[model samples]
Target: MKVQSSRDFKLQREVDYGTPEQNKAVKQIVADIKQEGDAALFRYTEKFDGAQVDSSNIRVTEEELKAAYNHVEDSFVAAIRAAADNIRAFHARQKRNSWMDLQPDGTILGQIIRPLQRVGVYVPGGKASYPSSVLMNVIPAQIAGVPEIVMVTPPATGGKEGIDPYILVAAAEAGVNEIYRVGGAQAVAALAFGTESIAPVDKICGPGNIYVALAKREVYGAVDIDSIAGPSEIVVLADDTAEPAYVAADLLSQAEHDEMASAILVTPSQRLADAVAAEVERQLRELPREAIARASVDNYGAIIVVESLEEGISVVNRLAPEHLEIVAQDPMALTGAVQNAGAIFLGPYSSEPVGDYFAGPNHIIPTNGTARFSSPVDVDDFIKKSSLIYYSKEALLRDGSTIIELARREGLEAHARAVEIRLENEAKGGVERGE
Candidate 1:
């Protein structure tokens, strides 16, 4: 890790928009799946995931869900159940009900909030299994009252034909019974367009590699999708009172996620900066994913020495990191100054991983400066709102002329006439009735 003055450093990471060739490939795959349905789905599953899947074995059976329990330890099941409870409890608080307001004028206005009919969660596999992601994605939709929550993961893990038992257990624990053995862009297409074995979903959530991201972008209009996520990031805003080891270890937790992940530190104390820079170096060597972490730290990581804590806050706002830790003496006091972080961890003990695993907050947050405008997955993500408008005769008569004027001003004669015709009809009816 390199230590530099805050004035001299600027964060820069090239956004990975898939190459033209890759984009073309993804479009073609989505088109094929949309056209041929199960035939293209099975063919691509074999070509990409090396799994000879068909309609017979495309979906995971109840027997497999039960057998997955035998492969996983009792401790994992217990821990997952506890985590699920916490997640459920937290999201349950975010549930919303349809509301209507009735006025004295006999007009009613409100919003009708309802859960999506179905949702698809894509879990990455082939070398990695994120059971945490399963809970993060599924629980919120469940809380929103989605009737169907389906999961799709790569058919193979570590070159084997079976899914990771942990992933299966997590899905079962999360109350998702529809599990499919398919992945890549084709999986996304199947989720969006439906195949013989799978049903189309109203929205797709979860993260994957570049190809998956491209496919999600391609199918976005047909079905809603979670954000196209970028690499993981962490920004630690610490002070002289912060421990160097804790700061360094927290930074490396994100760096070890992948080669593109960024870990940064911003502080006012020169002594603490020097200590953390050294500590990061010492800890980087011990991480199992050393090469990947080393590459991230060498390329994207930085420790900036600022003149004051206020200046450090300004820098943090500019970066808008996905995960932010404030390890100052008064971490909570600094939180109001932070305007742009996906998740904020205060004090040394509230490490980033706590939010990632056991914490109730959703870990699938916006990345690549998207925290500036977006939010993490939640109950709201799985629900849609429709504006409810009930205009009584008195209310419409009172507001009709104003609406006609506004619509006519915009050169929309049809809109204005629609309101005008109603008013005219009412007036003629009143005259005929001797009102």
Candidate 2:
């Protein structure tokens, strides 16, 4: 790990997200899936994932769903069930009901909240299996009352037939049965635009690789997407009181996620910075994914030494990391000062992994400085709101002139005429009927 001053340190990897060739390839794949549907999806799944997928076995069968339990241990099932309970409980609090308010003038003003009819959650497969992602994505949509929740993952788990048993078990525990054995850009397209086998969804949520992220970007308008997620990021805003071992361990936790992932420690104490830099080097050797973690720490990781804790906070807000940890004597004191972070863990105990898996909050968070404007996946992502406006005869007549004047001022005669016609008819009816 490199230690540098906050003033001189600069991030260079943000310039190129993915190669131009990768972006161009994803565009063609998305286009092919949209046009050719099932054929293209099957071809891509076979080509990329090295698995043969067809209409007959694309969707996971009930038998497969049941047998997935046989492959995993009872301990795994118990853990998943416990995590699902917490995830469901947390998201349930976010559930909303349609509301309307009747005004004194007999006008009804309110908003109607309706869950999406269907949604798709893309879970990555192959070497890594994210059963945690299953719970994170599906549980919210379920709480929002999404009727049809379809889950798509790669065909093979560790280059073998069928998806990971843990993934299947998690989906089953999360109360999702419509599982599909497909992944990557092709699966995203299948969810965006309906195929003969898979129906289209109203929205797509979850994280994936660069290709999957690019695919989600491509299909934004056709269907709603979560966000264009970037590499995983973490910023530990620490002080002299922070633990060097804990800070180094937490930083490495995210660094091992991918070679492009970034982990930074910003602190005012040069002594703590030196300690953490040494601890990171010592801990990096022990990780199973040492090569990937080493690459990440060597390229993107840093220990930024600042003059004061306030200066460190400014650097954190500028980076706007996906995960932030405030490990100091008074961690909560600085909580309100943090303007941008996907998730904040205060104190040494609230490790980043606490929120990633067991914690109730969604692990799928905004990345690449998008925390400034965007938010994490929640019930709001699965639900849409329609503004409700009911104008009574008395209310319309009272506000009609004002509306007409405002509409006409904008040179929209049609808009003004729409209000004028209604008001004129009301006046004429009152005169003729003697009401």
Q: Cα RMSD to native, each candidate? A: 1.9, 1.9
**Per-residue lDDT of candidate 1, residues 339-405 (tens digit):** 9999999998999999898879899999999999999889999999999999999999999999999
State every prediction's TM-score relative to the real structure: 0.97, 0.96
lDDT score, candidate 1, position 275? 97
Q: Which portions of model 1 show Cα errors greater than 4 Å?
A: 158-161, 431-435
In terms of lDDT, the poorest run of 10 residues in model 2 is 426-435
List pairs with backbone clashes in candidate 2: none
lDDT against the true structure, per candidate, is 0.93, 0.90
lDDT leader: 1
Model 2 root mean square deviation, Cα atoms: 1.9
Query: For each predicted model, how many residue pairs clash, with residues at least 3 apart or on different chains?
Result: 0, 0
